[model samples]
Target: MNHAWIDGRPGSEPEAVAAAAALIGGSRLPVVTGLATDIAGIRAALGLARIAGAVIDHQASAAIYPAVTAIRDSGMMIGAPAEIRRRADRVLIVGDAFATSPDLPDFLFRHEPDLGKATRGKREIRWLGGPESSADIPGAIEPVVCPADGIADALAMIRAAAAGHRFGEGPIAGEQAEAVAAWMKEAGFGCAIFAVAGMDELAIEMLAGLVFDLNAETRFTSLPLFGPGQAFGAALAATWTTGFPLRVGFGRGFADHDPDLHEAGQLIASGEADLAIHVSGLAGAASPEPEWSGRLPVIAIGGGAASWANPPKIRFDAAMAGRDHDGVLHNERFGSFVPFAATQTGTLPRAADLLAAIAAALGDVTTGAAA
Candidate 1:
């Protein structure tokens, strides 16, 4: 089966790779986005971007950045899933985190805490700033329903109360905030879980500050939910390689980090990026067409059998990790890389292999030009 395409026409894999390399070789500025691959694939992308002097961005950078920036700007106390599962006696969930997190149910209900309060025994779950009903959840939960826009103010009040100070007026009443703070202070170990999507940087920083304040009296930490793609994995790889997170550029022959300047969507929309290389190799639901599609020339590498709604100019299919081949991926429960065996073997190309091939082809193009 022909797994490559040029201008939407079927072609051999080598043809697609050569065409993609030619485009990258000729472009003044290329943006590599849609980084939904595993660690190896992301590292290969970083290598390609360095070689081609491209800007690197992940599809979910918007969701991942708030937490990252908050942590970088103001240090936060964070813990892994195993730590929360084993010892966290009180869990304070903020925003629609539970709705977005698929493993929240398993974290909340599937397992019992091993070390907690001797008096209560079971963990106490309190949800803040989301739906009013906890009916969807399996266990008993106390819901502090606040308006979506008022979450930041409510968190501020909570932070004040946690710090033994009183706020006269706020989104959350002084009495309620104090009551919540009292509960938090009574915990043996506390954990605050939040999702960064649709949340502003200030709000995330406030939540982190609240966790920090809570830590003054008792052990407290926070966990941020990741994304629709392998955002955390990509960010992790980028941090280690470039000394920065995602949204890095290599145009100056060294890695430079700038969240606003290197954003893929803005770069494509503003006509700064002449070409875009999109890599989406994770298997599950259909990947959404990027909003910046058709704005510039594009080379797309997608999951083995997945097809895009808006096909780019050049396309190549690659094997998906954990589905078509054995691979390592970030596990939220473990808060680390974990290996998974492939459910089925496939002859399709791997993303890392395809990316390495494109990089090699780009090198060949540069060598010919120099000669």
Candidate 2:
């Protein structure tokens, strides 16, 4: 009677759909709808949850919603994924690293690091020789490897130097930052890829302002990596539907996004959020303890085969976003959507489908009302 024991049950769309319907008090029968999320794994959960008439929440909730709020409060620009893959001649990966970014290993060289016919090529206007030696040094684009801890001073120093003001002049701050500032001034078209590792949520808006300032000197842009899995989709969808992304809640007949109030972990820990419809594929298991996982009615959804032999109190299994589900993901390169596919062979659904279903089921609930 309990299909939860079926290993990775959601590997099959049919099973995923059935599981979703169960969560939202729907039937086990088939449902045709679209669930979409910019994040990879959560996309599938969205599809499943929508069919289930359950709420849709992406795993990226922890990282993205805050950034979305910051962006809303401050303001942001537009530079898509295609731009990175095609036009990013010089790429500066700051703060964090992409887990499986295909473009990494010698991507920005005069020609892409390729062995096709042993031919060397240079795509960009000029080829900056050698690997990136520093983050502060201009044209010396490189990965920061800050691991979420060593970002603040580096960012702060860079910001100060770029602003033509001297902030810190220590070993890592003096020559290092000035070098990067010089590079920014020299770069024809540059983009800085930032992530939430070393800095807290409060620093995001300031980070945005810093990036914007760098632009005054040259082509400086910032790409904040939401997190593993479809970080962008969950954040973006929630924001679009309710004016805020990720950690937002619809328990009060209106969707609301707030760090102090809307964080999923905080809300659940405080007994604020009920009927949590969690979406993730990073790790298919849910929290064992209510405090750890948040004490609430959770409809956790995920990708691959169902990993939990016995899911959380209330749960559903979904498909993969990048590996299996058919949908779009924001490329870490330029903030554009990159569409990937999945099949019945591998488990994956899209957040769009799931959200659509939930919207359909909670028909009377306005996007704002869901807040």
Candidate 3:
């Protein structure tokens, strides 16, 4: 069966791989993005980037960067999901965290923390800027409805209240501030849960500050939700191989990282990148923006290409990790890389194989490091 296409027509895998190689070899600057794949697939894509002198970035970089930047700029007290679930008596959901992580509500509220009979009191769940409905969420939850952008302001006020020094007026004021402050002071173990998507760096930093303030009086930590793409897996692979996260370039024959300069979207839009190789193997993954492919030659690989409204110049259908093929992935719930078995055997080509083939076609040997 033909799994490769040239201009949307069925073609041999070798021909498609060669065509992709020619485009990458011929371009002055190429970019590899949409890194929504397993560890092996991501490593293979990174290898191709190194040989082709390309920039590497993930599709969810915009969403993932806030937490990364916050952690980098100001240190954070982070806790794993298991720890949060087992110990936290108070959970503060910042923003609409449940939007991206649907399992969070159940994971947190299905049962009380199993610390012991002494600390097995009802878990108090509060939402800083969460959804209105508590129908889906188990047990009683307090939703602090406020403007989406005002999350930072609310967090600042909460922090000031908890610290016993009022920091001027803001969205959360007076009694509400004092009440949340009292709540924080009373909690033995608390966690601030937030999603990076739709959250700015300032908000995350402010949330981190709140966690720190709570830590001064009690045990508290922050947990940022990650998802949609296997972004964590991608970052892990890229960092292990290149000693840098996404938004790295191999133009200087060595890995260099600059968040703004090497951004895949900006590079593609500004025409700095002459070619794009998008690799995504997740099932039901969205296609690259039309503007991206419209601006430059694109070679899209993996099951995600099926969603492209306008087919890229070259496309290859590949196996979806954890579904079509057995693969290892970063399981957020466990907070570690875990092996997943395929539910059913699939005939689709594996993304790692396809990427390795393209790298080989470039006439450069590629090597992968254990991730």
Candidate 4:
């Protein structure tokens, strides 16, 4: 299963790796992105980025930015899923809570209550936006139909009410706001949940602020829902390895992080990167390559070959982490690394193996040039 391609034509893996290595090694600036792999694969990609003096980012970083930025600006009181299921008697969800994770209802109703140690009373569920669904959520007293676009204003009103501050009317009525504020204050443990995929930065910030404010009087935490992708794992790997998160560059003989300037989309669109390496090893169809990616040569490695409109210079069908190969991935629910055993013994090479090969070839090119 050494299926590889170069310039839209069938080629050997060695040839493809050699061509990709040459393209990356000769470039003054290279960018590595499409980081949908597990921790092992991301670590290999980061190593290559460091050696190639490239900038690194993830395809889903844009969707993740709001929550990450919110956490960075105002520290978040994060909670685990298990803890929320066991302890959170009240859950305040904003914007289509079940849209991203369909199994959320199951977790909330069937799974959470089955916990033998969870002696808490029935949980209360509330929603802010999104169309109503037929799925029966336990203890759903009433659904608040707040506009999706007006979540920030709604959260601000809630925060102000929680803090006992006088603010003019906004989305939610003053009485409703006061009631919600009082519920949060009285709840033994409350969890504020929001899906970042559908949320704006201001909304996330407002939610975080509300949690922070509520913690003043009672125990409250946030459960920011992220879509199914190992983007969190990628970010965590980058942070632990480089002392910085994604959108980091290593061109100046050291890792430098710039969330705005060095973002993969901006760098590629601005013609700052001469070459790009797109890596994705997780399951599911890959997203289309950025439009600006056509400005430079691209080497793609992963399962997302179907998503690319324009063929890359070199492409390799790599094994999916945790499915075709063993790897470690961050479990956000429990905030731990879960060891995933290989489910299939496929011939497809692991992403780490492919990237390591490219890195070796790149090193040879560098060494030869220096000699």
Candidate 5:
């Protein structure tokens, strides 16, 4: 198969798709096609979802519907970082606790403590430990004794406290859980931010089953500090344009979305997305399939001459995300916007911008929210 590769930079989805489509017509990775909304990386992945019979997955998975359902079914609360930094005295960071970078504790105590904002005052800070005690809280500060494993017990206790009740069983029950519950009840204003950790293993639907249960009784909110650069931006853009996130299929001449039924990974893995219109930047997350189905045809559009055994021959070229054009990225520490500084390593294509070009090439690819 002659592969037509498109350089899928961070902001060039439309261009990448159009380029690949001009050659191969459609793709098979339904999940990759699903990101074709107005945002996420370059955001047109949603447009190609059904055409390729691929599942449109967010960087995580295609089951973003459950996340939406969770939000709608169980109302949530929110406080921006600006608010948390200026006003939140006690910050609770939990889930998949890994490395305790030096700057984290420093940010809570040193920087956030003295914000210039007058209305939102600052106060004492505490680091709620994750499974691993990565954050080096000083001896003086008491790290919330997050059990090595029993997060559910702690969560149930918190739930009980939030609901004006108490459960005496479980590891986090009794005094400890009560103490957290009391804190929740008393805090003038508090924020709880959730990430992919709570249930990255399960689909967003199943994950929501647990999360909604938490939101049922609490004033706390859950926000995914996302993975993949511009991930939130992508989700926001996609939903705005199409009313949904990843796993939009565009194969049947229009768009169709279903998280469980159409994940790109599953599609390609299952040999469904026979012709892959892959738009990737070196930095962003791509599918981690151990091998591409032997029959799969990949029109890989990107900015590298990288080779892989899975596809045997992947047509590729140079592309840009943070390079070539000034782009937008959020810092790792906090989701602070960082302006990209483009260097004229001036290689090949910009993935998102390329996708925009592809849209133009394909001509009149509708938003097709109705489809």
Candidate 6:
């Protein structure tokens, strides 16, 4: 196993673990953010947060807030990626869905006949906002080119048209609105796809409302694109363990979740957190670089070389979750847990192992202090 580091100096794993424990155990306010590891890593992070009285937040929670809020507020009719691939004959993409998942075209417009049962009719792909890019698959139609800020209004017009109501003189032309309404009327199984990143809350709400409205006449559902990381898995784990989503604080001697108040970025920026532990060991996941002028002490455990604008106080090169260690992950396509096997073996320690070591060291420090 490789030696971890404290203040850019190499040290034994035990030394680094004890130093990390001391830093966190003495802090009045500690935060555990950048939760991008697999399920087991998330469980360990939650346990450490409970012991340290820390707050937990994922790095991508800001990007994911729109979808979460939309689903929480008005309720969304959502389908899995596989379900959309199999059954959706008409696809309405609100923004550049390819930005989140580049393989979207292959998933929606693949030529393999044996992949699944083919739709009875030709698949219809339509774009609502932005100029169509070359990434657009064959036979895609763009009826409107609203600015990113205008998507909400455009979707409102579409929803009004779908509901036989008047949205007078909106960004979408009457002819285009009628055409989309006609498609909604004729679509056998329709799906609306959008990337949560770069999307506004109102636009997401409007998109969900549009899908819900279409359900009155035909079968329609929404699919939010999720990339390769533990953001979704971490949210699920937090919900199950703490009965709340991310941005949860344990400082009150219990789990208290407030998306706005306890957000990782907000807390760090406001100098509310004196110490932070960032855990991000998923394969291909990037480490988070929190921006704060307070020069807060940070203990980072993750894969990849550590290169932060403001270097952490303690750093550990942990094993990649699914590639270097085996664990379970939340499958967004099926809304279930799936076993992820280790594809590579190396001397690097897993995040779970490092976290448990830190927790044990912290416990020893507390016991010594009490005695």
* Global lDDT scores for all candidate models: 0.84, 0.47, 0.82, 0.81, 0.47, 0.80
TM per candidate: 0.94, 0.63, 0.91, 0.92, 0.71, 0.91
C-alpha positional error of residue 316 in candidate 6 after TM-score superposition, expressed in Å: 1.3
Estimate the lDDT of model 1.
0.84
Q: Candidate order by lDDT, highest to lowest? A: 1, 3, 4, 6, 5, 2
Query: CA shift at 150, candidate 1, in angstroms?
Result: 0.8
Q: For model 1, state the Cα shift of residue 147 in Å.
A: 0.8
Sort the predicted structures by TM-score, highest score first. Answer: 1, 4, 3, 6, 5, 2
In candidate 3 the C-alpha lDDT for residue 84 amounts to 77
Candidate 1, residues 282-319, lDDT tens digits: the string is 87735778877768888888753235556688888889
Which candidate has the top score in TM-score?
1
In model 3, where do residues sit more than 4 Å from their true spots? Answer: 116-120, 288-290, 304-309, 365-371
Cα deviation of 353, candidate 3, in Å: 1.4
Better of 1 and 4 by TM-score: 1
Error of 2 at 94 (Å): 2.5
Candidate 1 vs candidate 2, TM-score winner: 1
Prediction 2 TM-score vs. true: 0.63
Q: Report the poorest 10 consecutive residues by lDDT, candidate 1.
A: 302-311
The RMSD (Cα, Å) of candidate 6 is 2.6
Candidate 1 wrong stretches, greater than 4 Å? 116-120, 304-310
lDDT (tens digit, per residue) of candidate 5 on 303-363: 3334454542334443455555566655545655556766656645555555555545544
lDDT of 6: 0.80
- What is the C-alpha lDDT profile of model 6 across 1-371, one tens digit per residue? 45599998898999999999999989989999877887888999998998888999988888788877777678888787777777778888877666756766675556422223225676777887845564456565654577777788888888888888977887778778878877876778888887888688898898898888888878888888765676767877898999887889999999998889889888888888899898878886655465552368889898543667777789999988778888887765554678988888888988988998998888888888899
Q: What is the lDDT of residue 118 in candidate 1?
A: 19
